[model samples]
Structure formats: structure tokens, C-alpha cells
Target: MPVLQRIVKPKTHKGKRAIVNREPKLIEDLKDTLCIKGSTASQYVNNAMRDLYDLKKPSAALLQKKNIILPFEDITPIENFSRKHNAPLFMFVSNNKKRPHNLIMGRTYEHTLLDMIEFGVENYVSLKEFKTDKISTGLKPMLVFNGELFDTNHEYGRIRNLFVDMFHREVVDNVRLQGLEHVLSFTAFENKIYLRSYKVSMKKSGTKTPRVELVEIGPRMDLVVRRTKLASDDLFKQATRKPKELKVKKKKNISTDNLGSTHGRIHLGVQNINSIQTRKMKGLKKTMAERKEERKRKLPQNNDTDNSKKAKNN
Candidate 1:
């Protein structure tokens, strides 16, 4: 069989396994995003994309002053860039008179545009405006969505899902309290959506649990719903279908709860516990034949006369 392209020989076993996991499989790997900016990108748009790029650094790529590609009209160029970088998610920022301070974000299915949403910036507050310290790089953020429309309206629901898919990095089983360093919040009201970022501050409390506070660290935006191009129902369904191997299988007799303890049931045949061999003192150790003979023999009656004499002398 012909070998695959761009496959490098890894020196270590760990490196080899890492490379193997990168291959296409039934369970898709985490998707990285590409943050792109055009020549017409303004100061506010530039700052927003820059901050987002830094925040998503561990799994995102940034391309600045690149091709003036707009997903609304022609997405081919954007798709090509994404394929080159191996990023399935992308955000394009531009500020022209026609669509001033516009942001287009989307995901790709097989390097083809799946869906795109365009938002016009009403107002923006960059991180530079806030004097708060920036969060640690590569720390996963907690995502929160506010407003009833996000849960009720179909389009709004899609938008909420897209933000989660794009901004959130790899999934994890558990997280530490200190590891939860930041939060990204989305609020929609009166036909406008507001995006906010905050730094989580842990304060001393008289009790065991510390008091928590949210300090706004910006790159905040007041966005107006401008345009949306969604995928067809059939295509979207196909894209979201999970393979059998990726589904969580129920363990045969195992269960767990909120606590760290594990619970399970084990079935076995009836056993003669007395016949089982166990540790013995050196003096008591004996061969199989001796053990059988000893078991057959009976012990003498108690020496009641000797015990009575010892008690009388005491």
C-alpha cells in the first residue's frame, strides 16, 4: 500500500502515538480555529481578534493582513487557508463602509463552509481599556449563556452552540478550582448580543469555601445581529452524527457517584473458604499429608487437675 503524505518518523514511543492519534478516525479530534484579519480591519476589530487569538492560543492560528476573503460572497479562499493550517473553525474580521466593524465566524465540514454568522459591532471594549491582569495562557474558560432567546429561538440556539464550539478548547474529565481562571459570557437582549469576559477572583472567607468574584476583563462587544447563512437540515444532521465507537458504553456491573468512591457487583461460584490455603507460622507449617492426618486426629481432654493445682498455689 502507498504511504500517507507528510508523515514523519517519530523518535520516541510517546511521539509516535501522538502522531498516530492525529490521523482521521471514527471519533473526530478537537478542532482548532483560525483568526483572520483583512487589510481593512480597523483598530477595534484588530484588537478584538488579537485578544481572542491570544486567549485561544493553545489550539488556534492567527493570520493577519491576509487575503481580503469574505465568507458572505466567496468562502473558497478562507477554506483554503483553513485547510493549509488544519483549522476547521474560522473567524474573519473586516471594517469597510458597507459592513463596518463586521465579524464573520463559521465552521467547515470537510474543508467546505458549513455555516457562517455575521455580526456588526455596535460598540467594543478592548482588554487594553481594562487595567486588570490578563489570564494565564491555555487555561480553559467556563462558558455561560444568558437570555431566553438563546434557549428558545432556533437561530439564537445555533449561535450559542457555535460560540461554544469555536471558543472552547479540548474537553476534560475534571477541573481544579484554581484552574478555572476565566469565563466567557454571552447575553442577548433587545435584538443585540453582548459578549463579556471576566477574571475569576478567589477571596478569603471565614468558612472553608472561598468567596468568588467576577472582575470584568475586556474585549467586550455589543453586537447587532446582521446576517446568518446556515447549513441545510440534511447536511447538518450528517455532520453531527456520532460514530458507534465514540458513544459512551455502559459498564456491565460498575457505577460511580458524585463522591470519589466506586461501586460494583461481582458474581462468582460458591467456595469452600476453609479449604483455601493461607499464611501459617513456621512451627505450624506442614505438608499436605501431615495436614490431612492432623485434621483426622482428636485433641486430649483439658487437664483440669493441673489447672486446679496452679490456681490453688496462686
Candidate 2:
């Protein structure tokens, strides 16, 4: 009768185990729940740990703070945000995990593994990835990025603090520098960061020195110079004034025939001067003849004339 009574106890309902807790108790293996699913507390802790390990990272485009800039367009080009800065951000589920994760989660993307883990562990994950879109969700485990190009250093502490403080306020206080490991530079202005196996050489042959030259063409300056030149030219023209010509009126000849005595005196004066000029001319001609005779006497005369006379006598 004791052996028959041991076989008589009925099995409890499986749904009764679910009713004990408001949240679903994740059972990894239905076949081996007796061994792995310890107490509810232990299972919760194990699930928490597993969620911590499953971190999600953001795409390089979003991680660069380029996403934060206002007036965002869905078109992803090689220029704009891609050329300037880019980085990868990893999201963990809790404060115990590495880096930091944004706590605010989107309702539309609540079905992903990242949302499930974040919701289960009570935090969201942030990460960086190469292939990222609006549908992207979850915690990424690893990331490759350039430290110098990113706004992660002490200089850009404001931006970094802004992001960290916006997400995990408590965990951000404890985030430590893990020493620079996977550093890269995306300063070449490319939308995507590609790994180069060989060294890329850049020459400064035609590239001019970068500078911001200030050119001045103000209206005041232009007016001043132009007015000065115009004023100077006007003054010069004024200084060299030309004299005006006077017009002489024609007068009719009123007879000098009316003054006989005055005409006679004028004719007499003219005749006296002419007579003096004639006398001087006569004296000049007589003096020239005398000088000609003196020159003839001084010249060596014809010894030929004497020779011809002698030759005729002989």
C-alpha cells in the first residue's frame, strides 16, 4: 500500500512557474533547466552578466557627433560629416560593463536583441559600426577607430562629457582611459575609413600654404581715394588759368589830309634822315676804292711783264 501511494502524486502545471514572476525567466535549455536554471536570483544575475557581455557599437558615421548636428538629411555622401570626423562608440548594458551606453531607447526599435538586453538589464547599448542605418540596434562587442581624429581626448572634453552625461551619468564618472590601441586618422576627408596596407605618400608640389587672406574693398576707402584724385585734378586745372583775348574794333581812316603843317614836318624829318644815309653810303664807297688801291700796290706784281719786255728787245 506504501509503494502504490508513492506513484499517486500529480505533476504541477508548467504555467505556474511563469506566474511566480512578472518578467519572463529566460531558460537557455528546456531540456536541462534543472541543472542550469538555479534559483531565480542566480538566473537573473547570470542573465545580467550575459547581457553585459553583449555590447553594441554605433556606425562610424553616427559615432562622430556628426549625427548631433542639426538639419540632418538621410543621404550619406562622401563629403560633409564623412570628410571631417568619424568614430565608433560601443554600448554596454550596465555600469559594470566597459565604456558608456545611452540610456534613452527608441520605442520603435524595442524588438531588437539590443533592446531586449537593455530592457532586461535596465539600460541601453551604444556602439559604432561600418554598416549602420536607422534599423540598426544592439550592443557591439569590438570597435576600430582613430583616437586623434575623434573628439575623445581632453581637448574635446565638452563634447565627450555631453555624450557621456546624456547617457550613463553614473558610469561616465568611472570610465577610465584604456591606453590608446586601435588609433587611426580619417583626416583625408573620406566618408568611409578604409585600412591601408601600404604607406600613402602625399606631395606638396602644387598645394599652396593654407591661409585666410583678408581683402579690403570698403565703400568708404574707395570713395575717399576717388574724391581725393578728383579734387586734385580740379585744383590743378583751376591753377593754370588762360588769359582772355580782347577783340579790337575797326576804325575808319579820318583824313590826315586835314593837317597840312604836321604832314610837311613829318616829311621833312624823313628826308633829313635819308639824306644822311646817302652821304654815309658815298663815304663808304670812296673808302673801299682807296683800300683796293692800297692792296694792289702791296701785292707782288708781274716780273713776267719785265721778262717779256727783255725778250722782245733781244
Candidate 3:
């Protein structure tokens, strides 16, 4: 029997995986606005989508302690909590009667305490003031940042902003360090704030070819905050005290006669005195020589000599 032949059909090609609908006018408008070729529209959309996605997502490091706030009675418990959780701590002490409430955030309780002392907060209670249970249990909002977008703003943002300002003032402004791109990020753990600063540059990565990267231009500083009195004008005045006037020793006037034969040797060093004396002697000698020359020139033709000779002759 003559065998029957089976025909193999070719697979049909499916176009692009993603499909987006838009008005004809909108598509034309986007093309004109972007100033791109029709063929590159998909590529442009892909890039824009990627950027939008990135904006929507929070930083990985930042999200770890998103809504965590541990409370403690003493440094020992705070230290223990931070160590156990491996996160930083934040404490805000406010006096309703005063303005500029204290915003304290640090890696450790010890660091926070030191910072409080530095801020001149002598009378502060760690546990007595704050209800630790409320904070840890999420009964109340742990952090409240002052700005728009309350929903997006979190403890990390508040702490980052505070540290960035402080870092810029103390390190970039006071120390006058340059090429300080910005505070990359900060970690509060182990009772300290680890602030990382970077100098962003395009440099060669081993090979001749260069790539953009962040180079750490430290001090990866450890910051601390302590409990203190509420912020006030008096506190600011105390913090910014005027520099003490320098006590300059008054130089006693020394008499030239007291310097003896050296001629004011003590007042005007040996070299200076010698120069002065030489200059004076040179001037005196020049004047005396000029006077002697004048006398010699006048001796030949003098009215007094002529009168005396004429009188004698008469």
C-alpha cells in the first residue's frame, strides 16, 4: 500500500506579551512629547514603568524597622531590646509649655543618654515619662514626623532627616569637608547612630573603563541623644555662648636710656638697634660734611672778612 504522508504545520508567531490601550490622540501626543520614533514607544514606556515602580517601593534597609518602637525603663532594657531586635531606638520628650521638643534617636540607650546630656537635659526620666507598653504594643503612634504625606512618613524618614541636618551642620559646615554628597543612610543599633557619608564619583572599576559608584568619605560617625529639658531660648543661648575675650599681656614701655650703651637694645633687638645707629650716624656725617663744604665755599667770599680787612687797612 502507498503510505499516507503527514504535513507538519508551522507555529504562528504571537506579537508582544503586553498590551496597553490608549486613545489615538493620546498616543500621538505622547510620541510628540517624548520626541521619539514610533518604533521606540514601547522601550520608553518600559523605562518609565521601571522608574515608577522604583518610586513606589521603599528602600529595603528602611523598611526593616517600619513600625517598630521598643520602650524601656532604663538603659539596660533599651540596650537589651536593641540588641535583641537589632534595630535603632527613637525617643521624643516634649514639654507642652515649651517649644522645640527634644527629638532623640540613636542606636543605643547609652548613646541616647550621652546625647541628652550634651543637649543639657539633666532632669529626664526614661521610663517614668513614657508608657513603654503602649509604644511596643502599637496602641499609639510611635513616631510623628512634621511634614506632609503622613501616611508615607515613618520613623526612618524622621530620623534620617534629623541626622542629615545635624551631619551637614557639624561635619560639612563646621569641619568644612568637601565633596560630601550626602548622608547615604543611618543605622541606630548598639546604642549609637552609624552615619554613612559617600563621595559619588565616576571612577574606573579595576579596568580602564569607568563606572559611577559611591566612595565612602567618612566619618561613619556614631551619634547619640540624651533626655533633656524642652527646647527653649535660654537653652539655645547657653548652647551658643560667646567666646571669652583673650587676655593679651600688656607690654611695658622700656626707656631707651635704661638700655645703656646698646642704645635701646632690649626694645629694638641688636640688629635693629645697629641699623638705627648706622642710619643716624650716616645722616649726621652727611649733614656735617655738607656744612663743612658750605663753610669752605663761603670762607673765600665773606662780607664779615672783607669788612674786617677794609677796616684794618683804613
| C-alpha lDDT score of every prediction, in listed order | 0.84, 0.25, 0.33
Model 1 residue 305 lDDT score: 66
Q: What would you estimate as the lDDT of candidate 1?
A: 0.84
lDDT of 3 by residue, 270-311 (tens): 465554545445545667778899999998789779999999
Top candidate (TM-score): 1
Model 2 TM-score, 2 decimals: 0.13
Quote model 1's TM-score: 0.73
User: Could you give the candidate ranking by lDDT, starting with the highest?
Assistant: 1, 3, 2
Candidate number of the best lDDT? 1
List runs of model 1 lying over 4 Å from the truth: 1-22, 250-314
Q: Least accurate stretch of 10 residues (summed lDDT) in model 3?
A: 29-38
> If both were scored by lDDT, which would come out higher, candidate 1 or candidate 2?
1
Candidate 1 at residue 103, lDDT?
A: 84
Give lDDT for model 2.
0.25
Residue-wise C-alpha lDDT for candidate 2, range 1-314, written one tens digit per residue: 55554543335665454334323223211110000111122333333333222211222122211222111121122123222222112222222233122111111011111110121222212222222222113321112233342354432222222223222211123422222112112121122222211112233465563232222111010000000001133443443234343333544542246555332222233456654645446545657778899778766456667778899999
